[model samples]
Target: MGAPGGYGTGFALIVVLFILLVIVGAGILRF
Candidate 1:
């Protein structure tokens, strides 16, 4: 998926945000 340019940057950002949301949701449930 290394086509270079803006595509990879956007994809990575989306993946990071998704992971962060999952972690926050799990923490809230535990509390």
Candidate 2:
């Protein structure tokens, strides 16, 4: 699974983006 699991990075990036968006939304709501 050397180069076969390269897609994991893309999925991880997407997850990170989602978390960031959620955090930003929470901050906006709090203000």
Identify the leading candidate in terms of TM-score: 1
Query: Cα lDDT for residue 7, model 2?
Result: 82
TM per prediction: 0.81, 0.79
Question: After aligning candidate 1 to the native by TM-score, how far in Å is the CA of 11 from where it should be?
Answer: 0.3
> How do the residues 1-31 of candidate 1 rate in per-residue lDDT, one tens digit apiece?
5597788889899999999999999999999
- The residue ranges of model 1 lying beyond 4 angstroms of the native Cα positions read 1-4
Q: Model 1: which residue pairs collide?
A: none
Q: Model 1, 10: alpha-carbon shift in Å?
A: 0.3
Worst 10 residues of 1 by lDDT: 1-10
Candidate 1 yields a Cα-based lDDT of 0.93
Q: For candidate 2, lDDT tens digit of each residue in 1-30?
A: 565465888878999999999999999999
> In model 2, where is the ten-residue run with the lowest total lDDT?
1-10
